[model samples]
Target: RRDTGVWDGRLGWGRLTHGRAADVLKNPAYAGAYAFGRAASSRKVRPDGTVVACVNRRPRDQWTVLIPDHHEGYVSWQQYLQIEAKLAANRTSTGARPPREGPPLCQGVIYCGSCGFPMSTGYRRADGTADYVCNRARSDAVTTPGCHSIAAAAVDAQVTRLLLAALTPEQVHLALAAADDLHHRHHRSHRGAELAVERARYEADRAERTFTQVEPENRLVARSLERRWEEKLAALAQAEAALADLAAARPVLPEPDRLHALAQDLPRLWDAPTTGAKDRKRLLRTLIADVTVRHVDHSRAHIGIRWHTGATDEVVCDRRTNRNPTQAVELVRSLLDTRSDAEIAGHLNALGLRTGKCRPFTVASIRHIRQQHAIGSKRNDPTGPGEITVPQAARILGVHEAAIYPWLRNGEMPARQDRHRRWCITWNPQTEDYWHNRVATSSHLKRTNPNYETGQAV
Candidate 1:
């Protein structure tokens, strides 16, 4: 016989029970009783018993049981495994697997060996057989060098084979060992150099501060010293920031187990989802320094892999490669200066440069480039050469053109009375040009030309 009751104890809501000693204390009974107490830790459970009694603590703080034999104990059961399994299942369903180890071998990853720019990836057939191509070949086949397209499937297969070959037991061990050694040496050297540089900068700053503090009270001297100190402080701050960034950027050396896991799972990396592939690419970037691809023919290409772990394990893969349009543009930009928007556009078109969206470069795109470089009318330099149309000014200044009448009435700006009663606003060309020149001048010009001479131009 057993009796059960709800017990509201100091701990929290609980269940109290009393039962026959033999029945309550039996192994099966004990197991069930213990499970009940454990569950009560997170819930409320009441048991009915006599000789042996059980009482679950309140607030689920502990699973306590009181025996008629004058013994009390706590019990718990494993529950986390089920929860973990459910959570893992949920994650998989939500596509939350870990990131891939490498970058996608597409437009952003594949680079031309000759031009050093990303090569575009495209499908040659509907069968999903893709190709890596250079912008020069697709757009300006006549002028661009090595405009040949390579099949993506073929290249991927070749690269996979090469990677497999490199992942041999002996090769992997050597690579892992080399990676460890290199990482250790790199970490030590980098830290030492960084510390030395920081110390030097700190000493220099202290010396400069001391000198400035002891300097005479001349205003000019004081101003110069202040400027020097400010410059020194800025430099010191920048250096320290750079050092911190480098320290943070330095990759941690993977342990043996992690390295072995990566080696074991290298093949699956290629088949991973886009995110997984990206992670694998990042890891590869950490381990391997460079990949150079050269086109041997329309169908065949050679890839050379350079490991950053101080080992020159050059594995060649056969694939097709193309040049990046952006890189080609950069190369052309580097070779010439003062190129007009039209000129640049023409050059790119002739040299086979196209937009990432697969469109030919328009005048707008050329203008965008000039704007980026702060050149010509597209320039944003407050003092740069540009045209300011009245309508544009009206829109920018959030005013009606008619409102400009007030400026003309006050002679704040030049104007002419129209045939009707209205006035037409006009800018003083000389004043405008003078202001432009003043803006373009260096600090020395401000010192030399202190006054604008109201009516006079620069």
Candidate 2:
């Protein structure tokens, strides 16, 4: 309770369940700071050839990094601290208690392979990990540790991958169709806003016409109509403002074409930050009813995912306990600085360095490895002294393929169309200099803003 100075120096409230309140405390919106760090840990080695970590609650004073006033807050920082303290004080409430809801992603559906009991979830303070722990030993009042402990992330991620991959082309097409219908539905759903503007305009126009028809000598009627006209003008302005506000607040839904493209891009959707955990879990729960996890040795887990369609998928997860692939990942990253995916794959293949097992190196395989590790492209360096493609130009220009396409589409930038209809861009000093210094500043689309920065056409 005293960890973050939120303790009131008294413990009276019952234990706070891990619910929406807990989720808020973990959120920076509820906290005045827009970041998270509550505790820290240090590792110590024992004399018996073993390593252990000692975790300690870090008072905010010892926190080396902090950013204040980073965002709009739901509450003051002090209030946030007080809430944390009050919640922490509830842990020691002495009594038989009702079971709280578990993590949203794996509640009531996950079972321990050893004891066949549902695993309980907790937030690991040291690493801020949502962990699932089987506490059969503790439940039976034994001194030994629980039978199993695993981070819910690895399991959840694997399940999500399976679900997304299982989307057949027909299903993808259907999803695209639904999204297209939704886009049209939402766009056409702006009738209320348009109606308000129409009504206001009619009233304004009628008021002005009446004012114009009235005689000036009839000051009584004249003044009344004038006042009425002013009121209508104000109302019209308000309605227009409201409409503008609605337009601004409305979400930008993707076009049907973009949605169709996205349906084929499952990995991008799965990896995007905007995809919420609850939504992912919901998708997973729809496809898969339950999952049974069994640990094999230290770094491997046997995963059995049971689908709702009476099918099962088995997977083996190699979760490292110490989990430092820093050196290996760094090697791949360094290679990415100079070598193409194919070149890196060939290089690795020649050196007898395969990923975990003896799998052959391929360009597609290397691409996945790079995406997983967040390695940037080496296309900027002009591989093998040949003419570059649009994708290569994009890498050299530090932009996307979309930005390069418009230039080629229009006659502004020089491009050669090969027999394969592929746009081949030749590397020239003049073109390179122009693109690096360029930023789009003018409208390209008829009714929308430009696609690139500074709004200039390609």
Best by the TM-score measure: 1
Among all windows of 10 consecutive residues in model 2, the one with the lowest summed lDDT is: 95-104
Q: Tens digit of lDDT per residue, candidate 1, span 1-458? A: 22444543433433555444323333223332233243332333456433444554343345355222222322222233343344454464564332232234432445676566556666644344466667755554455576455666555555556656677666778867877887788788678768866875886677587666765857787777767777777777776777776676676666777777777877676566654655545555555555556777655676766666556544354452332355645744553344545656677778776764456776676555545554443222222134344443344333445644455577766555422222444445675664445445634322222222232453
Tens digits of lDDT, candidate 2, 1-458: 22335576654455567685577675545655755455688999999979999988676676656676777788887687677676664454642122243343664567788877777777867655676778776898764332677777767667767787777456767756766786676666566778988999999999999999998899999999999999999998998888887676665655656655766786677668887765555666667878887888666777788998798999988654334234445666887755666777787777766663346667776776768767765544333344678766765665667877788889777767642245777667877888767744333422223344344675
Best of the candidates, lDDT: 2
For each candidate in the order shown, give its overall lDDT on alpha carbons. Answer: 0.53, 0.69
State TM-scores per candidate: 0.33, 0.31
Report how far off residue 223 is in candidate 1 (Å).
13
- Which 10 consecutive residues of model 1 have the lowest summed lDDT? 69-78
